[model samples]
Target: MKKIFLVYSFLFSVFIFGQEKSGAKQFWENLQKQCGKSFEGTVTEGATNDTFRDKKLVMHVRNCDEKTIRIPFFVGDDKSRTWVLAYDNDRIQLKHDHRHEDGSEDKVTQYGGTTTNAGSATLQFFPADEETCDLIPNAAANVWWITLDETSFTYNLRRIGSDRLFTVKFDLTKTVGTPAAPWGWKD
Candidate 1:
């Protein structure tokens, strides 16, 4: 009876821990599956400016590793933006790395936050962090989320106390050839 009880306990422990690890791992794997792929995206909502209007918006899952992924977003001919997602210390972080055409860092770069919860196997949220608040005071209330499913990936952002909202959706079923390297990245 004692041996049987110990075996049951071990199995239960594995089931519980395995579920938690798999949730994160699943999301990471879903993203990794898109590595080396480029997808066209559209501004689905709250695109309040001409920046994205009539532009060829593209997102490339450019680089990936065990702990990090780099996705560059191209708007028309501009290649100044990259989104860096990193997993560490049991948390996921999101940051925007912006650069100029000449490979110089933009002043409003590296602004984002970390996930506050074990979101899900398909979604994660990042609320504005202290650094983001300091860099863009008006964005202090921002929250960003990314969702991935079998068919598509979506990136959304909102500011809790304001009219700010932005959403971009990319189709996963189709991919385009990789574009040129991002502004600051060497080929």
Candidate 2:
């Protein structure tokens, strides 16, 4: 009877382990499912002393997967730019291929961010500035803090050592297949 009990325990352990593994996969999958949606909002003024004022901006997150996502953002008449964001194990990374409106890359940038357990997302800034910036090698900022529901995330940008804060929010409900407009605008 003892041997039988031990066998049952082992089987139960395997079942639990399998379930946990699949649970994690499902969580990531659900996050990816948030892609293909377009969020219309304004890029509020950030904590910059610069003259960049608050204006309307559009953000489109699409082609999401466990590995990568395509984020295209634009404000006003400025040309739309696409960012390829990838999840490298624990880090969310972006390698800029500065493509012009003609689809040719003008320049490239290398940057990425680590995910926190505290429900915040941060991306480190490269080509560091000389003033008011922290030396943590990695300056962390809140990606999205305010939200009315789980499908939405709002981010207020606060530069390190600076008094400026900008507000930006994303709504995940507009997710549809790639729209016809350049910046994920509707037909």
Candidate 3:
């Protein structure tokens, strides 16, 4: 009888927590459409000394499941960046996974934030969370946003009190060839 009770309790918790917010449903659904595809983009906005300028930018919607989606972003031959999106019943999380050539994690990896509200299906915003602030103090006021529409997907970042801004716009009207698996991507 005790075993039965424990099993039921575990299942109940899973059922309650393994769900995503109602308003986020459509946004997740829309993003899922890009799974198994790749897109080429350009550094549409940034500082004059931006390293991404004139470099080949690629994003692959490589792996995805019900709760998480991983999109690897490649700049030229550098494949050390990936964006992880975690979906939940109350909010969603956006994390950056940075790695080195030997598949080792970088010091500034796993830095991101969770949605503060039920964002729209076509757009969402994530403000730097506590973890991010501790990892990068100057990023305390940073806000990252992604906009997805029928023709384009743009990833943007802005420092709330500064002029730091970066934007990359990928053309969704066409697909591109997928590149090699990003660093630290376990098979």
* Better by TM-score, candidate 3 or 1: 1
Q: Best candidate, lDDT-wise?
A: 3
Off by over 4 Å in 3: 1-21
lDDT string, candidate 3, 122-173, tens digits:
8889999999999999999999999999999999999998989999999999
Better of 1 and 2 by TM-score: 1
Which wins on TM-score, candidate 2 or candidate 3?
3
Error of 2 at 116 (Å): 6.9
Task: Estimate TM-scores for all models.
Answer: 0.92, 0.56, 0.87
State each model's CA lDDT, in order: 0.91, 0.48, 0.92
Determine the backbone clash count of candidate 3. Answer: 1
RMSD of 3: 7.8
Alpha carbon deviation, residue 145, candidate 2 (Å):
8.9
Rank the models by lDDT, top first.
3, 1, 2
Model 2, range 50-153, lDDT digits (tens) per residue? 33344546666656766877766655555445655555554444433244565554433322233333222222222222221232333343232232235564
Q: Which numbered prediction scores highest in TM-score against the true structure?
A: 1
Candidate 1 lDDT tens digits, 61-84:
999999999999999999999999
